[model samples]
Target chain A: MSKQIKGREIHLKSRPQGEPTPGNFELVEVTVPEPAEGQLLVRNLFMSVDPYMRGRMNDVKSYVPPFKLGEALDGGAVGQVVRSRAPGFQEGDFVTSSGGWREYHVADARQYMKVDPNVGSLSAYLGVLGMPGMTAYVGLLDLGKPVAGETVFVSGAAGAVGGLVGQIAKIQGCRVVGSAGSPEKVKHLREDLGFDDAFNYKDGPVADALARTCPEGIDVYFDNVGGEHLEASIGKMKNYGRIVLCGAISQYNATAPTPGPRNLTLAVGKRLTLQGFIVSDQRHQHRRPDFLRDVGGWLREKKVKEVETVVEGLDKAPEAFIGLLRGHNTGKMVVKLASGPA
Target chain B: MSKQIKGREIHLKSRPQGEPTPGNFELVEVTVPEPAEGQLLVRNLFMSVDPYMRGRMNDVKSYVPPFKLGEALDGGAVGQVVRSRAPGFQEGDFVTSSGGWREYHVADARQYMKVDPNVGSLSAYLGVLGMPGMTAYVGLLDLGKPVAGETVFVSGAAGAVGGLVGQIAKIQGCRVVGSAGSPEKVKHLREDLGFDDAFNYKDGPVADALARTCPEGIDVYFDNVGGEHLEASIGKMKNYGRIVLCGAISQYNATAPTPGPRNLTLAVGKRLTLQGFIVSDQRHQHRRPDFLRDVGGWLREKKVKEVETVVEGLDKAPEAFIGLLRGHNTGKMVVKLASGPA
Candidate 1:
């Protein structure tokens, strides 16, 4: 006999014009169906609310499809496989999947990746030991190619991926400088994250701050916030610099098309290379094991830290996401689901 | 005893605020110095007037030094050795040197490169076989990296470097499309240059023209004209496309800071790469012999054609340069100096 469970889920009520609002989301109670032939039912413990989620609220053909209107929103989440009909899975297995924005999910067993809690905490699997961690590893090492003694300038350095990028750069023996929206985040980047230098972009012009903080021009720039920050980075880049275009959280919510960096002409004279990427691309996915080995070791050694801002419930995911876009959270923002037995 | 010679040279009367004018130049007659112990005297045959020269007039730190006021301007030119005091050089040898905007030059023998007249025309040494040709060869092959059956889009395709880029892309088995300023240049690009499609950008919006011309979207974009054209190219680029930033003739004369492509955010989802270079960089210069072998063979086999707008007399050099910036000439713009014995 199958046991029916009632769970809370968040759906996209409507699409936002620019910046999202809580009204655009709806939380409702739903019946969790029994696991079909090759499927399993999951009890989500923690779900991610990220800056990239803002793009999904708009109707456009992107690397990932837009969130469907009037349906449950989905993203990275850690859950317990409470029921299983698939051969490779069993009841009470800890797993991670794109079954977020909900308390319980019913999906194919293939959708979930089994995580060993002995390796790290459940929330760490969503933050440092997960997608954001992998993004930092692939972006800084594979793309940025930072070598020892090279200076790396990271924007949004207090955020999930940016924070890890600075720490990883330090591990690579690089001189790391970062910019964040607030003084507190800047302080956190310097004091907690171990960035060589940090600045509040809101305090003064990014160009002036960059010049002052990074006396020698940047050899690599990790761009998480685009627009004026990107322009300023280009101005401060040394010859043959590499720019990793990881995210443009600053322009994601703009109602109009934002103008790019005007000083791109400098790229010609300086022979710079600017490249963009999506973390899920197969080329990057191949590096996941190596990412785990390196970042996992660092975490265990306490050389790298995992920072998170936890919201109380699934009903608060929309506000958390909106806050993420507004730079409200200092690091990875996650919504905590019901605290229950595994 | 050394023979004295009177020669005419062009001097920078003043730096221009925006678009350069003929008033900024002054042509003067001066005595050509006799060959020193290790120097040589040469009579100039032809000189190059390129879009890059505009940057040197702005009095800013760049890849090349700015043109000093009230001094003879120097650039790429082919000349005949009239007198020599160095062992390697002989009288009547054709050489290429930075002796442009003058009738004669006196410099150390090491400052010139001996060019074989049998390989190409004396003027060709200043155009197809010289700096412009090397730029297209290195930028397209190294940076763009077009594979067979890919589509390559080129802006300012009727100009010196761009024209070679389209032809070289075709040589690499790519479908080539181009954009030019005038209808006549468009016709020349399609009918004479063997481009698959060509559009006059002045006809309408660059976005509409690009969408219509690049039906399958672009795999490679050789950007010679920046601003709107660059913006349009980014909109039409396929996933993992490459953009080679060569020149920005469109923005060189802008009195104010020109805004960049507004769609750079698309680069992230599409995984685009935008790289810029200078041909004179030692790394690119290392490819010179390979460039000559391939492009020189193409020239001999008639697979590639070198187009030039020949401006007669050194007096017309200033006007020709101004016109070069305004898109008044198709292909390479070069000034033919006095016609004399080699």
Candidate 2:
């Protein structure tokens, strides 16, 4: 026990008032705890920062429980097992687990899934081959159900989950249109990601951009940013269009009740289906095999590209998360707690 | 041809800018043209006026085509066949057909269904046994999918489709709650229609009314009046709730677009499904046999009660339709075009 080291963690210092600020997070030091029977101790290499975490900072009830003040905030992270007291796991093996925002976490052997470096990069396990990837996979294929000739529209198109959605739709032989916050992000969508069309929503009204891009109307909409983006997509939706309500980053910071899309009534006349979902609810569907098999092959073949905004140091997670909410990141935003194995 | 009589019809005089006025309709006398070969001439006994007609009054695109200016509005009607050139239909037979804003209509014999008056009343064919009835059946059973003991909330609960929705839900063993415009409508929903609870939304905020009525939360919400009713229903929805988007009469008359339910983002966390459909889409899924057998049995056994607000004369149809949009009627609003044979 005396040979154990010390580690640091980011805690939820205080709940935010509208939008979060630096004051909401606290960094504290703690002794690295030993792995119990059937548990393993791991050193986190990378931890994800996402828009959904913003909801957890609030004291209200939500799909995920609120982050408690004075306690470490937990989320998705990739780590290497340093010590094992469990079956089928050994030292130096990389695994993905939740309860991250910390340098070290003692997890039950089954809490993390062992990752294969031969399959993909270690960090890719936290982004493309992980939760975000699965979300895009299930939400698009199961709910959006885009056909080969259909036109699909996605808000937050250059984002973690959304980027994969657009790419998957393209692979499925659909024409894709994307909306992003910056011109560079838009360029990434078109020139890099091969979207049929892309628009910078910040430059103009979303409805106008959608009209110009989706002249034939949208058959499916993958919604990550809500509010105006959602409304515009609905306005341009064709008969029997499908909307996958995955996230709504646009309304997360709203102090007052945000207005919903005005044109939702179009659903009735168009016979549209708007389905809202949380990725965790569908985890039992065992879509990981398809995600890794398809996405891993695409990664190796360079058919799919991974975009990331990496902020160095564990202390930088708060800034990365806040930046993500502001659409400052072009893709998956992660805080690097430690460097890769030398 | 010698016994043929003249009939007057109401035409769409002009597209209404906002709310429809009497000037929007033009009543004119037209000669009773003789039925051609394989056609039937019928004297309309009763005709229906529904909220969806308001959309037709506009010159914009919708699920149904816009009513052409100077052309008679067409909708559900029941009549007695006066003459027939077809084999199936006979003189004095009762039938139901579309294209009914006139006192008498000439139609291909196949265009109308020869309806038996033994199952239900002739007017019930225009409401509880006709299009509105089918809408209630499909939207609730097919989309809403309520289970036994679940709480189902219905808006515009005393209206034609909504009334049948509550009764059908009750028969399915659900705890039904309803909201209506008037105290009398609410009383009828509770005392006569057997709703578990009822509220007059005209008396207070819809959110408060829903909270009071649905203390345990709503499982299935059949949305009729879209604005606040839809918003309030979303707030009280349970996990995996299903919302049947039936109508949005509250927003139909607005010159500008109406705001959707702001809390719709709750769908992500609650995993709610909000599906909008036109009754016509599910028509091929003919529920007619089930409707006639079950609803007829309910009517005969006195488990269900039917209500109608009758306006005498086809000349008064414009007012009847206008009043329906204003929530001026309880249950089905029908216009008496003529009386049947003595």
Per-residue alpha-carbon lDDT of candidate 1 for residues A179-254, written as tens digits (9 for 90 to 100):
9999899889999999999999989899999999998999999999999999999999999999999999999989
- Local accuracy by lDDT, each model: 0.92, 0.90
Residue-level lDDT tens digits of model 2 in B53-110? 9998888889889999998899999999888888988899999999689988898988
| Per-residue alpha-carbon lDDT of candidate 2 for residues A161-210, written as tens digits (9 for 90 to 100) | 98999999999999999999898999999998999999999898999999
TM-score of every model? 0.98, 0.97
* Candidate 1 lDDT over residue span B1-342, tens digit each: 465789999999999888988999999999988889999888999999999999999889988999999999999999999888998998999899998999999999999999988877788887779999999999999999999999999999999899999999999999999999998999999999999999999999999998999988999999999999999999999999999999999999888889988899899999999999999998887799998999889998888898999999999999999999999889899999967633
Candidate 2: which stretches are off by over 4 Å?
A282-284, A340-342, B282-284
In terms of TM-score, how similar is model 2 to the real structure? 0.97
lDDT score for residue A339 of model 2: 72
